[model samples]
Target: MIDDAGSTLTAELSAYHPLWHLKRINWLEGFGASVPEDEPITTRVFLIDTGVHVGHPYLSKAIDAQLAIDFSALPFGLRYVDGINKPIEFDPEILDHLPLSANDKATISQLMQRASGKLCKAPLETALHTAFPSHGTACAGLIGARMPGFFTDPLPSLTDGKPALAVPYWGVDPLSTIIPVSTSLNPTPGQLILALVYALQNQADVIHLPRGISVAWMSDNGEYDNPGLSLKTDQDEAEWEALEALLFAISRTVPIVCAAGNSGENSLAYPANLSLEDKGENGIISVGALSSAGFRSSYSNYGPGLTVVAPSDDATVFNRYQIRINELGRRYRLHDYAGYVGAGLPRVDFSREAILSTDIPGQNGYTGYSPLGYDEDDDTFAHANDPLQGAFTLFGGTSAASSIVAGVVALMTRRAKMKGQILSGPQLKQILRATARGTPADTKADDINGDKASLELLFGSGLVDAGKAVGKIGA
Candidate 1:
């Protein structure tokens, strides 16, 4: 249950995401079967969201700075532009998302042949709409935080050079390169289509869209409701129709992971709900947020289309490091709430609980910068006294969960490369469904909207099993 009293439950002196907080990282080693591979092929994950700060050491160290692009700028037609407004190095081998004429390929080849390394701007700066990397950077870090071997392989930890529990675990695959494309927080349907088109042409292995467009709807009382998803009436068919075609085209190329919104209802959000029917199954994978206690998050939306769940708040029974899934799994230890702790119904404290990640520099939310949000202190709730408050902050939503799954997708691809396995988009979804861990059976089904069948309303297939998904490639 969320505490309306506005009390702080968990705080600390540093800014980090402990492995305990992100229990999914531990699944890289096959959940209890095999250990992490010695060396895996590096893959690329395309982040389609708020722009990221490419200079951040944490993300920069793990990614190729050359692959970053910003789409929230002028000339939205061609593709996601660089900070200086130049075209990305087009290689036919990696880029097959868009069908290009032979002449087009020849022209690109000529440009690359005459390319100069110093094409960057004199004074580096991205457009206002695209420069802020707050949300996108955070998601990129979770997928591949530039730490030591710790990020690539999860295990025991030592905080500040001392043995400490709840060690801030980093990315699922630190070696994966990130292609940062700045799609706005609230982009028009036109802008959304362009971003999708770019992802396909650019050779993105796994694409993560952490935001959704909620169309207004009318309630039973004849009153228009707030911005929520209305399948039939929300945003005209013409608007979403063009984008859905692009979505179908892209889904066939790469796995697109989208968030299931944070509205705390049983509604379906667009883009997140964009699925291509193949073999009588939906191709889009929607991710919901999970609490640290291994239960469905109270603020997470639940309904018919959820594909899997991941952690958002790090204060539940699932986050405890030493605890294994044995006979002792019956009793769970919750961090903030001590009330009635049961199996899957782990209660979460929204205020004091969150996933720490990279924040926009000098924004109103973080100290060193001016206000970015309407209120300068919008992010103070997450980063109160951290020495590097301006660089890192905390956030908890389906956005974070979506990125977590995207990171695992990178790991899955890496495992596939080593084992000479080639699994398509549909195959990956089946592996996730077969291997995922089920959520608490106590929560009631989401029958809010009529005529919707649900295996588990709160969580679709179940909690994402990172290790099992990767292991399936070799099997």
Candidate 2:
């Protein structure tokens, strides 16, 4: 559907399937020389997650390193903090399962000694010390991996030589900038709130959180929203109001894109579900995942308050994530690259189910998993782990989906900015809903059902159509 002079193509992409999403959104069609230089400055996306690896070639190219902040060090004793609900202390038992070699473990302890006197401590000896691996960077990559040549334009329609045809260039907004805030290795409610303020103060147009904040009582009836909620009071109704207020403030200015969680239930994840009413009018996007084949992912959360769907996987192709056969003849999902598992992470053969992006050089896998050797693709692992310099690894979940939407928002905002218009957060949400097409209705568990609008509960306004959204700007 290249309606313009071969500049853009509209194809339904597999979420963050930059190659896919870009074509579906017809991204390049709007790329005009008339855009001002400061458009990117006004359209920054702040990803509040694990913090980016800041080293992947594609991400490194796309992100603003100057805007990156590592809050993992700010919230003391949070090296292994995952969430307030899943509280993690620096447990001695974790010592036994650390994904490091003996020498690397010793090296971490020694590095700690050297960092003790420093103003801020070292990030981590490796990904081993972290509760999660590649969380922030993977999200960042999804938001801005224009990507390396392979990912940006994966499937190119060829010429039978009748006439020279052009396949539109594909990828997220290459011009957009990302401001990464690494809340913690494990983020608490306090850390999340702080991250929100920091991102807004720094002038982010979009705020993307990859995970769901577990709420004790947010089933569409709870009315507590304060912006001053603390770690100790995270579960308190009083504290939740504070959290909601913070979300409300951020959404008023910057569109807050959040994952709808992966429980596969009909429940909605908050902040994404942070509306006084259910249609999510407070500038929150409760993104659900669609497999590449245009069906609701079995693992994606649904029901009331959900905003839109994006492709993380395709049902017909994989029923989970959209898999791609790479140039190396290796089968993998897009952006979810193959790479090595460094120290301080749980070891498992992660090649089959993760999104690959920039990593802290020589990072580890997830925590508590046994160390693994190559099961099938030795060369892919070898290349990924070579001196562990590539700084690439895999990650997944609604976090990736949320960031993908954030990327689209960035594109929309940037496009609008160039046209002498500014899209407020609420307006952004409205545009997405108005422009979106219908997606597969929920039929997974057979009984998980509800209705928030005219459409089926699970799919929201359907899959987010980025091309249509941009087209609606100023209209």
Best by lDDT: 1
Which regions of candidate 1 fall more than 4 Å away from where they truly are?
1-17, 28-40, 74-84, 87-131, 148-157, 160-169, 214-239, 276-282, 314-352, 362-389, 439-455
lDDT of 2 by residue, 1-475 (tens): 2233243222223222325544443445543331345424446888877655554456666676555555455433223222222222222332243233464334333322332211122233443344343566667766776434422333343323221212222235556777776665444455565566556556777888887776545557655333334333434443345456557655766788889888766777766666335434478778987655444665677777788877674211222223222323333433344442132332211112333444444334321222322324224342232334434444456776677788788878877777778777888898888877773332222222322324547677777777678767755
The C-alpha RMSD of each candidate to the native structure, in angstroms, is: 11.1, 14.0
Minimal lDDT window, size 10, model 2: 161-170
lDDT string for model 1 (188-261, tens) is 55455555555666667788888776433223654433322333543433444545555655565578888898
Error of 1 at 308 (Å): 0.6
Instruction: Give model 1's TM-score versus the native structure.
Output: 0.67
State the TM-score for model 2.
Answer: 0.64
What C-alpha root-mean-square deviation, in Å, does candidate 1 show against the real structure? 11.1
Best by TM-score: 1
Collision count for each candidate, in order: 15, 30
